[model samples]
Target chain A: MVNMLSIKNLHAGIEEKNILKGLDLTINPGEVHAIMGPNGAGKSTLGYVLSGRDGYEVTEGEATLNGQDLLDMEIEERAVAGLFLAFQYPVEIPGVSNMVFMKESVNAARIARGQEEYTAGEFLKLAKEACKQVQLPLDFLKRGVNEGFSGGEKKRNEIMQMILLQPSICFLDETDSGLDVDALKTVADGVNSQRSPERSFVVVTHYQRLLDYIKPDFVHILADGKIIKSGDASLALKIENEGYGFLGLNYVEEKA
Target chain B: MSQWLEDVIAHAEQPASNELAATWLAEQRNSSLKKLKEQKWPTRRTEAWANTSLVSVESRNAKPTPANITSWDKPAIPGLDSIDIYFVGGQLKTDLSTFTLPEGLSIYTLQDEKAEAVAASRFAQIKPERHIFGLINDAIANSGVVIDVAENAIIDTPIRLIHLANDGVENHSRVLVNVAKHAKVTIIEHGVGEEDSVNTSMSEFDVADNATLYHYRFALFTQKALHVGGCHFQVGASSYINSTIVAFGSDLSKLNIDVNYTGEHSNVDINAMYLLAEGEAFDLQSTIEHAVPNGTSNEKVHGIIGDRARANFGGRIHIHRDAQKTLAQLNNRNLLLSRRALINTKPELEIYADDVRCAHGATIAEIDDESLYYLLTRGIPRSQALIMLNFGFIQELINDIEIDPIRAWLTDMLSTRFKSMEVS
Candidate 1:
């Protein structure tokens, strides 16, 4: 099977600190990869690097999507290439409406792939349907992007965008942190419905609860900017029960 | 040489320009012209022109020359239909004038003696120590748009004042708009021209009791022109006024938007935008006077500077000693798109009333990188995203532009003016 994403010897960091050092991971299509890590173990940095955040410098190794060189592309080009990342801390844009932002984004990706941009009516139809799937209210589309949303609402909004965008490979960085049970279920369902043999998902989480709901095919444990263990979904249980300290790693700083 | 100034003032014979003024108004214009000759041209030493240059005004000739209108061409201003008026060099282009005055409203150029005298007396309480251009507008304003919005008449359409400059010679012009009690109307002053020749202009606005006005101005000009204009608003009891000024060019431009809430419960909202690029210079000096009790005023201005361009904003909010519950706020923010660009913003609040709420702030900085990258991650091209971010910064206030035609016109001008800026 062709791998949907491949990261090898990835050494990335912001400023002087190397947050993601010598990290190697491979994600195949149809697989849900759950990355569980200690607080500063490069989990979020990895997500940012994959999405091409400006400040994070990628020093070593290479990351590729399908067979294309992903690390070398610009941020927007990478997004057009089917990379979608749900940020851990979403920024609030004061004046651009969510609907306008969504439509522009959808058409931008479509145009990059030689597809015609969606008409206003078509864009609204798709946006409305996605909002329903994520259980977001209709009025959410009228307000500025993430301007006045609550924490859970913001998370649901991100998932709603993911549904509308429908990228080939999606990255959810701590998307479940602020969600309530109902919101979490809606988000999980939104993700599950998009699962297909040709699509892949990378879910970076802080708790084992999201894993129970997400049902990942593989689980990876990361510490000290590197992934130390990888196994089937059961690996999440060992880490959840043993608390990561048993791996000869001082995860006390992470737990604190 | 046929005297250009004589030809400019002899615009009365043009039927198109004199369509609105009454017979008596034409007679009053002669007296006003006599008055204009008595005053000397204003200079930078004056209090109002403190931060501006007076080179254009000092160099302009004041003389008697036989007129010839044959060589002049009709000028064009984008979104011309929005207003009805013949433009000046800042002189009136008599051949291209039109007037479709709404009911209970009348417009007359001071060139008409009878109409000029009637305007002078009827609105005598609203004048502010007439300047040289004001005198010119009064004496020789052979073409001026006079608006007398009837009491309680709600005008749904915006009356546009289109000023087009047609000659390579100096010209001066003026605008006077009066709204009666309980009347509602919006007068848009769209100033767009490229005159290698210089020009000076003024607009005096009056709003009576319980009236409302949305006065918007768009000045996109060339370095050869210098816009030293003034806008005086005399607000009556319980009236509301919103003023928006968008300035893009001028070798030197100074707009003093003065608002006086003369009666109780009057309110004023002033918002302006200035985009200075290349070697152009732009400045907006605003003064808000809360003269009566419970008067409120708010001012917001944004400047976008690039290359060697410069922008200056001096916003002053004053609250009278007896005025209580006066809420005033002034904020000015600028983005320096180039390191060579310079901008100076002064936010001043003078509150003699102890119970007033007056606050002002100014900030200048570059666009945030995180914001740039965030948009990029959403698949917006870097350049496109930068434009979006800039647009987004001003979207909240810009969304208030009610007329579709004007809104579209503003968008078109903004997009076309900035080469690297994209609208789609």
Candidate 2:
């Protein structure tokens, strides 16, 4: 069995501050990995570095997706290569309708992969089904992309895009942070419905509540730019009860 | 002063044998020529023309006579339905035009005795001395249109005016619109031409009490063309007026628009959008005066400049002491796509009334990188992402357009323009 995502000795930072120092992680196909850490443990930085976000410099790292060099690809090219990053804070793009944005994104990715493009009708059908699955109103398709959307709606929109793109490696960067109980379930169900033998997800969150909905096969405790410990799903339950104190790590709230 | 001013005065001194030109038109023309000669051409030293330079147009002589324009294909705006009035080389093409006036609406050329008389009587409403372009237009304009809408009448369709400029010709055009009390109408003016041409045009609108007018102007000249135009509006009591100007594709263009509220409780909304690329220059000066009490006005100007293109926006809102309870707002937003592109935006508010609400704002910024990155993360290429963001910035004003076909047509035109800029 091959690893869908592999990172070793990964070091990244923004500006002069180093966030991820010598971080190592592996996400095998069909496995859901949760990364829980104390505030400044570089959880989000790891996700951003993997997704090629600007300002997040990867000083020393080896990251691959399906054995391909992820560091060498452009931001959009990385997206085209079946890497999806559901942003914690999705951006608001006014005037570009959600339907148009989704169509262009899906078609661009497909064209980049040398696959057949989706017709308008076909794309509409697929988008409608995806919206239904995410429990979002169909009228949202006509509105601007994430413009004036509520917090929960934005999260659901991210999941909707994730489902539509059907990436091989998914990075859920705190998707459950601001969502309510119902929204969390809706997002979890959307992720579960798309789960396949060839799909993998790296779910990063501070709380273990999301793990109750989307069961993870492995739990990693990241601190000070590196993963210090790894265990099974039971380890997340232990952290939820005892917090990071049991691991002898001080928990300072990350100011972002 | 440059030779263009002398040529303009010489052209105005020539005599004509028309009955309409013998009365007030002749005196007004003489007075405007005197004013133009005394004032000379506006330069950077002038306060109003501080940010705009007319050096390029100072030396070019005006074409006194209308060019002999041959028969050409009738111009059409995709998805627009209107009563078409066509002009070629500053000459009205009555043969190629079609006008079917509905009840209480009349359209006539300035050559008609009755129309010229009507225009002459209303000539005092617009002060040509305020602008050099207006003065020149008033002195040499030979072809124009006069439209009158009767009281309580509402024209459902827009009246379209199309002007096609001839190569190396200096064209002067004028438009006079009179709307009676409780009447409503819409007018759309478009200019399209090829080659090097100089055009100076003026439009005066008289909106009566309780009447409404929607005026839209689109200046789509060629790269080598220079356009100078003016719009003067006198809004009456309780009337409503809305105006939008979209300017693009001119080597150097300047538009001066002024609105005066003569009656209480009138409302005016003015919006303008301009796109310039590849060494193009555009200047827009708009002034809204709340001369009477209980008037409301809003002005917005947006521009996108790219590739060393230059743009200027001067928005002025004036509230007189008698204009109490007036509510006025002015905003100018500009986006520069390249480091070389330059934009000068100024919002001026002169208020003497103690009990009025007046506010103004101006902003010039490049495209937001965070927004660009957000789009890029969605698998959209850099160029396509830029085009999307640029269009999105101007979509607010586009949404204000009530007509569906015109809105769709403008969206298509703007997207095409964005793509061309990206290519260059």
Candidate 3:
């Protein structure tokens, strides 16, 4: 059987310097993987490449989903192709309403899938239901998208879109970084409700605390542009207790 | 098109009448016509005409036929069917009109002999040096609808003037409005024509003491046409005048809206929107002369230019030396969808008085790419996403409209136009 997502010998960089060198990973549909690494290990660069962001050129290798090429699609096309990236720093757009943007986006996705667009009532119902699960107020949707929103609110709103789109492969990149305890729990609870046997997620972070709530089925240590170790949930606590220093030899050499 | 254009051009200068008018008025008009003949018709070479040069009427190579018929009846906008007079193609179409106006509200055509005082103060008082069309109007104007709202009489119903012309034709029409002291009224003038017609005309409005008026115009015509119109307003003391213009018709058009805020504590609000596509052009020239103290004025114009079309806005605010504590603002913004599209804007504020609040700003740019990507990531198609963002740019000013029908009609038409122009 084919792996749901495969990244093999993936090397990428930001201007003149290589960030992800000879990275390799593969995951099936029923897996939740956590990628923990030290500073400057290309964790964010990997996220940027996967999301089709500009300026992060993929130098070599394939990052594919379901045997289809991912790098060649437009950013929006990549989004419509069952992919989601919860930004580390969400973008704010004034004057564009949150509700109108979401409805238009949902309809766009539906139209691409050869389905009918949602009416005003149908969109309201879907958006309301999503807001309930995420614990966000409906009125927040009426204001401009992310204008003047708190840091925590911006992250929650990103997850709100994730829930609304229901992408098969969701990448929550540093979602819990700026969030407080309550916002984190609400966001985590929202994510937990979205898990399914046919869906998979890659949660990228520097710390392992988020794994306490997400409970990744697999933990992979990514350091120096490559995965050096793999283990179960306990590997996260091992990094939490030992600070990624005692994860073994490759990590020590990486530090040096 | 020229044949149809000549028919209208012939109407541009009303035949000089032989009737014995009071000497002062007749000489006023004669001298004004002489002034029209003295100066050449403004061309693309003049400062005011640099961006919106007036193309000659003879370019059509044919005379107007006076019979450019149409297939579509003007769609029914709320409160439009109740107008006092209905004119199409410079000819009154009485059968299409239905109304039972209040006691003091009535319409009179210029052909009627009752226009003695009106023909004097309005026609003779017009500034002949600014535009050539007004002079042509003075020389050839045959008739216009005159609405009179008496003092202490509040007209609950709006008076609408609908001007419709045919394809490949030049349409010259005129209208005069009189709002008496202490009276309240609203006037909506819409100029619509086929995509292939040419339209040019001027209108004069007067508001008396303690009177209030809401004046509006919509340029929803064909893209193959050219339209130029002018509006001159003399506002009285302690009165209010609000003007809103939506220019979307014609391939090339220029609109001149000026208000002489001559009254103390008088208020004026002017707002406009233009949507351009292809080789189409939208031009606006405005002047607000503050002749008295304690007057307030607000002006805002928004434009969205697509394809290779161009939009130019020229505005000037003039305050007299004695006019103190005046408040005025002018803002203009443009959205260019194509790299080749252009928007030329100039906002001028000339203050001769002290203790005034006046400011102006102009911007030309493409839609925000970050905003575009953000919306697209949410599943909104590229086209719908653009419409949503574009509407937000003008929503605040659109909300500034108090009359419900004008606002709704503008919104609906703009949405449809936006979708039709959707970038493929």
Span of ten consecutive residues with least summed lDDT in model 1 chain B: B62-71
Candidate 2 lDDT, tens digit per residue, B282-369? Answer: 8898888888999999988888888888898888888999999999999898888888888988899999999998889988878777
What range of 10 consecutive residues in model 2 chain B has the weakest lDDT sum?
B16-25
What are the models' TM-scores? 0.80, 0.84, 0.84
- Per-model DockQ against the true two-chain complex: 0.50, 0.57, 0.50
Let me know the DockQ for model 1: 0.50
**Model 2 off-target regions past 4 Å?**
A1-3, A6-26, A36-42, A56-69, A92-157, A176-190, A206-213, A219-256, B15-24, B61-65, B69-75, B96-104, B150-153, B380-390, B419-424
Please provide, for model 1 over A90-203, each residue's C-alpha lDDT reduced to its tens digit, 9 standing for 90 to 100: 778866788888888888999999999999999999989888888888999988888899988888888888888889899999999988888888889889898988789999
- lDDT per residue (tens digit) for residues A1-256 in model 2: 5578999899999998999989999888888999998888998888788878888888897999998899988888888888998988999987788998898889889999889999999999999999999999999999999999999999999999999998898899999988899999999999999889889999999888899989999999999999999999999999999988988997777777
Share of native interface contacts present in candidate 3: 0.52
Give the lowest summed-lDDT range of ten residues in model 1 chain A. Answer: A247-256
What value does the lDDT take at residue B377 in candidate 1? 82
What lDDT is reached at residue B349 by model 1?
83
Error of 1 at B304 (Å): 4.2
Better of 2 and 3 by DockQ: 2
Off by more than 4 A, model 3: A1-27, A37-81, A103-139, A180-183, A220-231, A234-256, B1-29, B55-80, B84-89, B95-100, B124-129, B194-196, B249-251, B403-405, B420-424
iRMSD, per candidate, in listed order: 1.1, 1.2, 1.9
